[model samples]
Target chain A: MDLLYQIFVDPFVQMGTAPDLLVQTLWEGLVSGVLYALIALGFVLIFKASGVFNFAQGIMVVFAALTLVGLYEKGVPAFLALALTIVVMLGLAVLVERLMLRPLVNQPDIVLFMATFGLTYVLIGLGEIIFGGDPKVMIADQLYLPRGAIDVNMLGGFVSLQKIDIAAAIIASLMVAGLAVVFQKTRIGRALRAVADSHKAALSVGISLEQIWVVVWFAAGIVALATGIMWGARSNVSFALEIVSLKALPVLILGGLTSIPGAIVGGIIIGVGEKLGEFYWGPLLGSGIESWLAYVIALIFLLFRPQGLFGERIIERI
Target chain B: MFYREAGQYKTSYAADQAIFPVLQDRLGLIAILIVAFVVIPLTGNEFLLQAVMIPFLVFTLATIGLNLLTGYTGLLSLGTGAFMGVGAYACYKLATIFPQVNLLVWVVASGFFAAGVGVLFGLPSLRIKGFYLAVATLAAQFFLSWCFIRIPWLYNYNISASIEVPTRTLFGIPVTGPTAAPVTRYLVVLSIVVVMTWLASNLVHGRIGRMWMAVRDMDIAAELIGIKLYRTKLLAFAVSSFYCGVAGAMLAFLWLGAAESESFNINQSFLVLFMVIIGGLGSLTGSFFGALFIWGLPIVLRNAPGAFGLSITAATVEHITFMVVGALIVFFLIVEPNGLARLWQIGKQKLRVWPFPY
Candidate 1:
């Protein structure tokens, strides 16, 4: 009976007793969800433009952050380092399109996916060699990201929110709105959508597949940079951050692989669901259920909606 | 030519159906088996046996397990490391419970536990396909890895949270644990790998293999043809996990001698997947080639600088190895996406048609 209460009722009772903690947890979850959505956004951009899964998005986040920090450490001004990092990401986008995607064109999806895995190793090796293996501070002060927290009184208690987190949430929303504009208003965006719909059809319509690939990859690179800054401000910039960024995979599937809005909604759902499960039900199982809870949630959700919440309905014909 | 199969005649279905129907191929198989069974163990140094050969074989088993699913049945799985962990933990628990049972028996039996877990995870594959299925398997990977760490019972409540292999004997010869001879362990691992590989070969060459291939080529077409997609996929999961389970058991007991949950992390899954891709998909011979290349490349790279009399720091070498391996993978994918097995076939083809281009 006690076990039943613990599993089924105690967490809710606790939530009822301490509503402020629930709100605090939800806020934290929302902030992290926005970050997860950013990473998933990078994935969606590349996957939509090209049919490739692009497993290197997580590493790209780390690499971009590492470059920003590594450049700053070399006596360059913070703004100059940021500009140089953008240039480097642009260079990387061009290199990837020419070297990796171009030659591997028309290969099976799995082959392209594995190629991205190779790209991951290369970036990891390069990042470590250049920046050393140790973690570095994100240079948040120079970047002028806010510090400290705000205490809001509610529900007979006070909820403390990190100012940096609030900034991260704002930045994420602004970037998404900007991306929505670029995607909706630009000629390149039209070409990208056409290419995404059908490679051959897009080519027949005189769309340069190569140009679109480079543009999409560079755009994704910018997203990775923004994500790196937000995520690094929250924690130390390190290769370990790459592993944590894998939280985006569940987010990717939850939002559906091809949907932008899906990614955002999925990220928040996974983030909030993960925090709630970890806070309430974690003790019943163990304290570290946070590691696998998002995946389990996504897995259960996948059972009912295989194409995801926003993915196009899959139709098969012989 | 020496490699010609021109004179070979098959008068019966069994003769035609033989795995090595060509005379040269059969001879090649015998030569390789002799080297594996007799030549290597008898003459190989301890490091060669322990560090290279045993790990190569263990990874080969895991690669084969994964290839049977991803390469054969067209189900991409990322939970291979966890399935292998299941086998290791099951073997560890089984050994502790029934101390007198032959350790080898427990190693093979533990595969059943992994298979069950594999099937449970694989249930999602019926509704999910492609990358989605892959992510679902990641759930298995992370969840089982968590279980490995969180459940103290899996490791017998070891203070260090690692499974330490006990000294297990086979026919009065110590085969596992620190005091065991490297050659003894090598021989035991070699036997298990060889037998399991042979069984895998037979499985892939039989009717079941065709079912898996049909599923791989197109599940809908296979379903229309009356091959139950669910049963085929689940069987692939069960059998693949069984192979991975045995490989994990051997990896822990025969190779590493002790292991923590870290040994079976997602990186291990990626490493095996790389081997499968680099070696060749859906080919048994490719599994060996893939294992050897992926596992052997680092050792070769690490030793190359010393051989060339170049002085470099160990850290530099490690980083360079990563870059080189990554570059080589891309280069190989670009040069021949079909994998090294295809290259091997091409080499044999060139030899057969020497002095003339086909």
Candidate 2:
């Protein structure tokens, strides 16, 4: 009976009694969720524009951040370093499209996916060699990202919120809104959607697959930069940030691989869900359930809807 | 012309269906086996025996295990490291409980535990496929890794939270544990890997393997043709986990002699996946080639700079190796999508038709 109470009832009762902790956990989850959403958003952009899964997105985040920090430490001004990083990412996109994608066109999905793994390896190697493999400060102060936390009294208790977290949430929303406008309204967006639907058909109608690929990859790169800045501000910018990319896997699948909004919603859901589970029921499980908790949640969701919440319904024909 | 298999005749069905129908191929296998069993040991290089050959064979087995699922059965798995961990931990638990039994038996027995866990995780495969399924498998990876750390019983309540192999003997020869001779450990690992690899070859070439291939090529179509999709996929999971389990057991007992959860983390899974892909998906021989390339190349590159009298730091060498490997992966994929095994086949083909363009 005591075991049952501990497993089922105790955590809820604790949440009710300490509502402030619940709110704080929720806020933390939302902030992390926004970050996860940003990463997943990068994935969705490339996956939508091209069928490739783009495993390099995580490494791209680390690479972009490293390039920025590495430049700053080398006496380059912050804004100039940022511009140079964007240019480098553009160069990377063009190179990838020409060298990797152009050669592997019409190949199986797994082939393209594995090629991205290759891209990931190259980026990691190059990033380490150029940046010297050390964690660096994100230069948040130089970039004017907010610091410190705000304490808000709610429901007769105080909830402390990181000012940087608020900035991250706002920046993520703006980026998403901006991406949505671009995807919906731009001529390139229409071409991208056409190419996404059918590569050959889009090409038949005079849409250049190469151009679209470069554009999509560049867009994904920009998202990675923004994600790096936010996440690196929270923690140190290093190769360890690559692990957070794996965290985005659950979010990407949960949100549906092709849906931008799904990425955001899925990221938030997984982010909040993981934090809540770890906080409320962690003691019963001996803590550290956060690692697999998101995957389990995604797995459960996948069981019911293999296509994901926002994914198009899968149709099979013989 | 010298390498050609042109005048071989098989008078019987059994002869026709022999694994090495060509006499030269059979001779090649025998020669390779002789080199592995007799030649390397005589050289008496402890580093080669312990570090290079043992781990190579261990990963080769793991790659074969993963190949059975991802390469043959068409289900991409990312949780191989965790499955291997299950085997390692299960073997540890079983060994501590029954010290009287021969350690090899426990090594094989540990596979059953891994298979059970694999099947449990694999249940989702019926509903999910592709990257979604791969992500689902990560649940097993992270969850099992957590269990390895959080559950003290897995390590027998060791303060270090790592499984330490207890010395075990086979016929009065110590085959495992810290005190075991490297040569003895190598021989035992080789024997296991060779036997299991032979079994894998037979399994892949037989009716069951065809069923697996059929499922891999098209599950819906395989279902229409009377192959049970769920059972076959689960069997692939079970068998794949079995190979990985044995590999993990050998890893702890023979190669590392001690291991923590970190040894079987996501990176291990990715490393094996790279081997399988770069070696050639769905090729048994490719597993070996992939293992040797992925495992051996870095070691070779790291030493080559030193040998060449270049003043490079170890970290710089590592970074260069990563770049080289990454570039090679892309290069291989671009040049021949089928991986190194395809290159070997092409080489043989070219050799057969030397001096003739066609």
Candidate 3:
């Protein structure tokens, strides 16, 4: 009985009168949603260019963040460390394309997908081996991001928002907008779309697919870094965070694998949904309901529209 | 040459139909079995036995499970870890409820629970395919993981919510828990693996296996040809989950001896999937060989540097191992999409045509 009260009833009772707690919960959800979308965007970029699911996006987040912090700890300036990290990411993109992706080209999608599984291990081993296994604090202050909270008066109560949360939302929006422009307007973007559509057609038209794959993978690495820093600022940087990346799989399902805007919308929905569930109705389930909430929502969406929010309905032909 | 198989012809179909057709392979397998059962138990170090061999045997079972679904049946799954947790939890629940039953029986029976869960989740496969199906399995992963943690009965109301293995004797020989001898535990696992892997191979080569292949090659055509996509896919899920579940139960009982909700997370699923891919999809031999290679490398690297008197940090060894494995995956993919199994096949083809151009 006491377990029920502590696990379920008390949390709900607390929520009924706690407007401030509601606002705090909403803010945290928004921050996490943006981070999830950023990671999804990494997945979306590679999927958009290569039509491969790019399972390595999660560890790329860990790898990029680990590299940045490890570089800084080794006496590189924060900004310099950031630049060096980009170079390393670019190097990795080239190495992957040259070493793995090129060989995997024209293979069955499953084989390529499995290759990413191998890549995941390589990155985990590489990341942990190069950077120590211990979780490190984000270089937030050195990166000039605000760490304080802002007081807000709303809904008949006072609420607090972390300045870092606000920065994360803004940065994610800007990055998404930048990608939207590059993919929709640029010539390289057109070629990537063409290749994503039909590799044979794209090749016959003189498009260099190898270049597009490398460029897109490198772009994913950058998004991964952005996600890493934002998420790391909220918690800590460690391989443990790799598991949370699986949550983005549901986000991809909700938003559609190939849509940039879909990732943002899906992120917000999951973020808000998880927060609301945990705050308002979590007590009903004895708390910790947020873990599967996004999946349940995605499941409902899949039943109705397997094509996703913005994706095209797949048509089979012989 | 020692490798030649001349004058070793089988006198009957039964002899030819033996598990290993080639005499040399038969001999090699016997040598390995002897090493595993006798040599390693007495001579191998703790790290070799515990870290490499035990995990290898367990994960080899797991890789076979995933390979049956993804590699053989042509279904991609992201929920393997959750199925494993179900197996582990089912064993926990069953043992708690029926304390009088033999421990091994409960562990084996736990797989049925996972098979049930797998079939339920697999219902989506009838309506969906490819990436959509993969995403659908994600639901199973999240839902099952959440259940393990939220349900108090799984952990017996422990504050930490972890399942601890209980001590038990099988035929008066300890097989699980702290007091069990390593050799006894290993032998139990080895026997189970041997039996289950044989069953999997038999199933894969039989009527059901061909039906699965027909469906994988072309589902609509297979349906037109009377292969029930619904039943076949669900059976794949059931069998695959059963294998994974048994491995998970054994993992919790015989290896870790204790586990939390986080014990069988999504990462473990991906790792198992990697083993199947790198091994050789559709080949049981590839399962053991791939598991040994991928799982064994770290141990070999950790030990080799010391043997050579070269001072190397564990981190450096780990990183180098990553680069090597990464390179090997690409090498195998480019050179042989069939994986290490294909390489082995090509070598055999060359041997059959030795010293001849035509």
Candidate 4:
């Protein structure tokens, strides 16, 4: 009975007792969730536009950040490096569409997916070769992202919030809002939606699939850049960040493969859930449950809803 | 001309149903078997046996395992490394527990443990398909990997937390551990891989294989046609994990001689998947070819610089190899998405019709 209480009740009791800690955990979760959502947003954009599950998105994030940092280290101004990085990503997008996706068009989704795996390898090798494999600090101060922490007195305890976290959340929200506006209120957005819905139909109506693909991939690249900056500001920019970015897969699962809002909500849910599970129940499991907790959460959710929260209902035809 | 099967005739159903239907094919098979069982063993040096051939065979087995599911049953699993870990850990525990028992038995038996875990994780495959199922398998991958690290009991409370392979003799000949001769370990691994591959080939050619393939082609259609999708998919998981388990056991025992959780991380899974996809999705022969190419590419690349007397640093060569391998994979995928197996088939077809353009 005590074991059962410890399993089910004690975590809640702790939460009730230390509300400030709970808030702190939630804030940290939200920040990480925003990062995860940003990664997933990149995934959703490319997946929706190209039907290619770009496994390279994570590496693209690292590559983008690496380019930014590597250029800054080369004595380029931070903002110019940032712009050059965007251009590099755009170049990458065009190269990918031309080289990988064009030839592999009409292949099975799995084949395309594997092609992205190849893309991932190429990016990793290229990134390491160019940037040197060591981790580099994100130029947050030069970029003017906020620093320090805001300590709030609440519930008889002080919950310290990192100003960087607040900036991340705000920037992530602004980016999402901007993307939403662009997606909803633009001519290019209409073409993207058309291509996303039916490639054949879009092509028939004079929308160039190739051009749209390049555009969508470039957009995904930009998202990767923004994500790289925020995530790198939180930690050192390194290839190891690619592994953490894989948390976005579980996030994608929760959010659905194609839904932007689903990606956001799913990322937050996975982030908060993983944090809470680790903080409360980690000791019971020897304290490294954070690695698999997100996956487990996603797995449980998958059992109930295979198509995910915002994904279209799957209907198969013989 | 030698590849032609013009005069061959099958007088019986059994003859018609033989795996190698052509006379040349049977001869080719026998020749390859002779090379593997006789020629290579007698001529191969310690380095060849230890570094190239054994790892190749080990990965071939693992590739076959992944191919069985991803290539045959249409279930894309990313937890192969973890399943392999289960087998390795299980083999370790079993060996320590029953010191008197044959190590080979434990290696084979460990696959069952992996199969059980595979089935447990594969339960989600019924509801989830495609990438979702892939993520579900990642759950298995991460969770089991965590278990490998956290549960010291699996590794017998070792300080380093790595499983040390105990010396095990086969008919009083040392086949594992540092004391074991590479040739002895190679023969043991070879025999097991051959037998298991034969079993796999037979399975894929038989009714069970058809069921898996049918499900792979279209699960809903297979179900409507009265092929039990649940049983078939689960059985695919079981058998695939079984193969991977044995491969993992051999990998740790016959190849690495010692292992920690790092040996079976997500990268291992991806590596095996790359072999499967690059080899050929649905061809057993492709598994061998895929393993050989993917595993051999790095060795060849690493040696090529020295062979050419290039003055490049090892790290630079390593990075270059990565680039080349990456570029080659994409090139191969573009050139023949069906994998090297299909290319082999095309070659054979061209050889058969040589001197005449059809």
For A238-275, candidate 1 gives per-residue lDDT tens digits of 99989977899999998899988888999999999999
Q: Which window of 10 residues has the lowest lDDT sum in candidate 4 chain A?
A: A171-180
How does each model score on lDDT?
0.93, 0.94, 0.85, 0.93
Predicted candidate 1 versus true structure: per-residue lDDT over B1-358, tens digit per residue: 6888777789999999898888898999999989998999889999999889999999999999999999999999999999999999999999989989999999999999999999999999999999999999999999999999999999999999999999989899999999999999988899999999999999999999999999999999999999999999999999999999999999999999998999999999999999999999999999999999999999999999999999999998899899889988999999999899999999999988876887
Q: Which lDDT tens digits does candidate 3 get at residues B201-251?
A: 899888999888888888888899999999999999999999999999988
Better lDDT candidate (2, 4)? 2
In the range B307-344, model 2's lDDT, one tens digit per residue, is 99999998988999999899988988999889899999
lDDT of 2: 0.94
Predictions in order: chain A TM-score: 0.98, 0.99, 0.93, 0.98
The segments of candidate 3 whose C-alpha lies over 4 angstroms from its true place after superposition are: A1-24, A70-81, A141-144, B1-48, B158-160, B315-327
Q: Across residues A1-318, which tens digit of lDDT does each residue of candidate 2 receive?
A: 999999899989988999999999999999999999999999999999899999999999999999999989899999999999999999999999999999999988888899999999999999988987778999999999999999999977999999999999999999999999988999998999999899999999999999999999999999999999999999999999999999999999999999999999999999999999999888889988999999999999999999999998888766
| B187 Cα displacement, candidate 1 (Å) | 0.8
Model 4 spans with C-alpha error above 4 angstroms: none
Quick one: ranking by lDDT, best first? 2, 1, 4, 3
Alpha-carbon shift of residue A291 in model 2 (angstroms): 1.1
Chain B TM-scores per candidate, in order, are: 0.99, 0.98, 0.93, 0.99
Please give the distance, in angstroms, between residue A120's alpha carbon in candidate 4 and its true position after superposition. 1.1
